[model samples]
Target: MAAQAEPSLLVDYAPVMLWQAGPDRARSFFNQPWLDFTGRPLEAELGFGWMEGMHPEDRARCEQVCQQGFASRAPFTLDFRLRRNDGEWRWLLETARPLCQDGQFTGFLGSCVDITDMRQAMEERRRALAERELLLAELHHRVKNNAQATTSFLGLQASRATSPEVAAALRGAATRVMLATLVQDRMFRIAENATIDLGAELLATAQAAVDVVGRPGIVIEAEMEPGLLLPVSQATPLALIVNELVVNAARHAFADRPAGTIRLALRRPAPGLGELMVADDGVGLPEAQRRNTPQGCLGLHLVPRLARQAHASLRLDVDGGTKATLRFACG
Candidate 1:
């Protein structure tokens, strides 16, 4: 191995600014980088002179942390703004530790790292996040108002319909729209964290659909596994798919029956994957309808497209009744 470089020479020319202060809390040494950073000579920065370059706002806090460290003879870290040689203020993160010789307290040694760019980037990120939250809140408020207005208009139209079937159809449409709006409101409630518990949302959507479409004798129930945490992107399409499925089952599956049962289930069956099943114990799908899929039904039409958006596979089981199972990525 080659000879070790001089320790003092390395400290004097290190990339970061380094300094030392005596036990009296009076700075006694300044490395070349520290002097070059301030564009000042060693004598000009010795003792309490180095603090002259620090921002006025930071001086008191810096003094307090430094004084506390000095009094306790412990290592400490602090952040402050200091003036550069170019007269620009930059953030400096200072870390200092007590120095000892022969187990006896001697002085304090410290290093300063320029973190101005990092701090600025972090501040910009925080600002952008706040703006996004405000926009989402406004969107949620507008959607809620629009849903209520549309539901009321549809209700009025249903009341004017001469036929009960037409009135029921209009009410179902209103329910679907309101379901979307309500789910969005819930999503925005937790949007600040950019995550959603998808299972819970599915259960809520299923229950709401039954409340809207159920008659006196109809029963709609849901079995949902909680803690299916997923991103916001997954929430929208999945919620849409579930809402459409439930609404479809309630309207068409039980179209002829005075009362029936619709069951909804959600589970995280495997890692990075979620499974959702909507089954109705009512009239099964017609052979042609099951074979060709419902081209005329808007809800069924949207189901396949929504499944694709959610990156989920759709399987229809029309054994005794209509059962739609969807498996999608949760990660």
Candidate 2:
């Protein structure tokens, strides 16, 4: 007589649903958990009857995958919605492997776990992330608009100033505010990570500063890599430093010359290092300032402070014209 199957050999009392199939893809056994979950008896779940409880949208693909796995006699996994005993649909993760006995292929064994709650939780997290990104973008937009409005107010104040020196100082302040505003604007347009394209932002801000100055013969040129990215923390200080250097050049560098060219260039000279240069073909810095004292030039004094904030070294050279260089850690 054939040996009786051990109780442990059967999955009938297991918590999870389990099944066995014959070599011809005919159901041979369904554990108690499987029958209870589907609310079906042994006869109703035989052969292809189990497919009746699968969601219609998942049936075709599930069958195709099953056929492929069976043909290859390899372990496989699939996810689909199955109708529960309470008439509710729940997601399930089903895994199956070829079963062998007596050194020969006999059939397949499969197990399934309900993953409806996990799947729903994952979907909720995804939606929440998307909503947070949208809200952040909107906040950046509003901040940028407010900053630009402040810049305009400063411009009006500068226009009404009686002294040329006071007017220039107010205009410089307006440009500084605009620098931060530009950064916010770029952040709003980019992805959720809040990284700004350093080169592009610099080029745009330089052009805007020049336009605000309204110097008839001064031209701004940019030579920058296409997509040099920097986080806002680094970009803001670096941008302010550049704003100061460019404005300083436009104001004093070309005082005696009829026309001048101010060039802004960004280069990666070494790994983890970046170089930003502003060079102008105009009268060089005053002899006293070239000595690095920067007496009476408020913007020039602010340069060192801004460079320190960006963790960069600032250098000024007067060969041919003034060239301001800022070297910082980029990576």
Q: What TM-scores do the predictions have?
A: 0.88, 0.68
lDDT of 1 at 35: 88
CA deviation > 4 Å runs, candidate 2: 1-46, 52-78, 83-90, 93-121, 194-197, 220-237, 284-311, 317-320
Tens-place lDDT digits, model 1, residues 193-260: 48887877787777776677656566767788878887777777888887888778877778787888
lDDT of each: 0.85, 0.84
Residue 90, model 1, lDDT = 93
In candidate 1 the C-alpha lDDT for residue 105 amounts to 93
